[model samples]
Target chain A: EAGVAQSPRYKIIEKRQSVAFWCNPISGHATLYWYQQILGQGPKLLIQFQNNGVVDDSQLPKDRFSAERLKGVDSTLKIQPAKLEDSAVYLCASSLNFHGYTFGSGTRLTVV
Target chain B: ELKVEQNPLFLSMQEGKNYTIYCNYSTTSDRLYWYRQDPGKSLESLFVLLSNGAVKQEGRLMASLDTKARLSTLHITAAVHDLSATYFCAVDDSGAGSYQLTFGKGTKLSVIP
Candidate 1:
């Protein structure tokens, strides 16, 4: 079975520029999540989608970050006017239920 | 807001030593998950503890949960270099469904030869 897929593996963007990361979850997975993993810290959930409907997004920065899971299979996370603090690894994970979350390789975003 | 805390943020031990990492959460949860992550890599699921007194072991690692205390532990028996990695504990609230996970800061382990 294929695991969660994400691209590009790495991204470099200047401050004030916009960047986007894409994720394709495992087949038949019903839940998808986006997380930001800063250096030396655990991954923090930015948003969650359950079949194209948002389950939680309380931690996302509404003014700069946005995410959507169209058709409940693929998802996209976008950051506008990126800041230096936004540089981190963006991880996408999927699960059939509450167990066995499979994470993608993640996109390392560097905002200069 | 739910909070998860892991003890001994950094640990270094000689090979063959034994150690245990503790994870404590602030609220009741449906399940607790353990994940291992290497440097510059994504998370890999290790164990999922579903109920009180749940214990699961794989190789040299054992994970146990005490839901009544809202705590979990990952015990490493006869540690090896391959066990060196950041360990994270995450909690899923019962009513929050499957998407939200509250994660601890993580415990970084290093094994010496």
Candidate 2:
């Protein structure tokens, strides 16, 4: 009955620094997703995982962004050498077998 | 990548009125999802329409899908101020090798009293 959980509701980092956001999906959920929502824009898919195995990550910037959902339970999204454009709300969502997603209160990243 | 578009990006309406928000997708898909988000908050699942002519309603909000038209509609009946929020419609990327939701630029609705 619990919702998806994300940590560090807000974060601030300097340009070129590194940062990470954590997420814990709901129990028995098989799909996990990470999305980046820039101000006034739609949430863009960064990565998606189906039970620890990556189902899609084509939108992720491999040179800077990386994500992993280990053991099919929790996920973490990392951005290395963060840029000003990387300042956005990182949202984590979970779904049961490709159904509707339940999102977490995203981590707002502010890169200075 | 699938492209989703929602018309009337911003709407300001008076309470007790009626309105509809439209969502259009670029591809053919059978399932469409609608979500509502409040200011500084997470998305809340509103309706998951799985087929053509599928309609679901809760309280004053109603959603319908037309697979052939690649469109969905969110109709607000007797609108209330509590319905003020951003509404987004999404569809799964049916392209090869990817499975993620493609979201539309949301429709921010404000119901004035």
Candidate 3:
């Protein structure tokens, strides 16, 4: 089975600019998650999707960050007006009915 | 709210030594996972422990979960340089239903030769 796939392994954007990251989960998985990891800290959950429908986004900064998992297969996380603090690794992970999660390579974003 | 805490945020051990990393959670959860991550890399799952007293081992690393105490441990036996990486423990904070993981601040291990 293929692992979760992410695109644009790296990205650099100026503050207040917009950026998006893409992720393709493992085939047949029903749950997808987006996490943001800052330097020297643990990964924090940004959003969660259960087969296209959002299960949780409590931690997401709706004003700047938004995520969607369309068709219940692939997901995209976008950050508009990126802040310097937003410079971190954005990770995507998927699970089969909420078990055995596999993570993607992640997109390293640098907000200048 | 769910919170996970890992102790000794940094560990430096000599090769061929032994050490343990501890994870404590502040909620009721049965599913616990241990993941390893190298610099500039993604997380690699090492162990998934469900239920009380579940222990799993692979190579030089062993992981144990004690649900009664809301704690989990990753022990390194005869540590090797290859085992030097960040280790994280996550809990399915949704009580085994949603599987939304709440991760702990990772334990960074440096195995010196």
RMSD per prediction, one decimal? Answer: 1.1, 1.2, 1.0
The TM-score, computed over Cα atoms with residue i paired to residue i, of candidate 2 is 0.96
Clash totals in order: 0, 0, 0
Off by over 4 Å in 3: none
DockQ of 1: 0.78
DockQ per candidate: 0.78, 0.79, 0.87
lDDT of 2 by residue, B1-113 (tens): 47899998999999999999999998888889999999989888899988899999999999999989899999999999999999999997656644578899999999999
> In every candidate, what fraction of the native interface contacts is reproduced?
0.84, 0.84, 0.81
Model 1 residue B82 lDDT score: 94
Q: Which parts of model 1 are misplaced by more than 4 Å? A: B97-99
lDDT of each: 0.92, 0.91, 0.93
- TM per candidate comes to 0.97, 0.96, 0.98
Query: Compared with the true structure, what per-residue lDDT tens digits does model 1 show for residues A1-112?
Result: 9999999999999999999999999999989999999999888989988899998898999999999999989999999989999999999999897676889999999999
Candidates, ranked, TM-score? 3, 1, 2
Model 2 lDDT, residue A18, Cα: 98
The whole-model C-alpha lDDT of candidate 1 against the native structure comes to 0.92
Chain A TM-score per model, please list them: 0.98, 0.98, 0.98
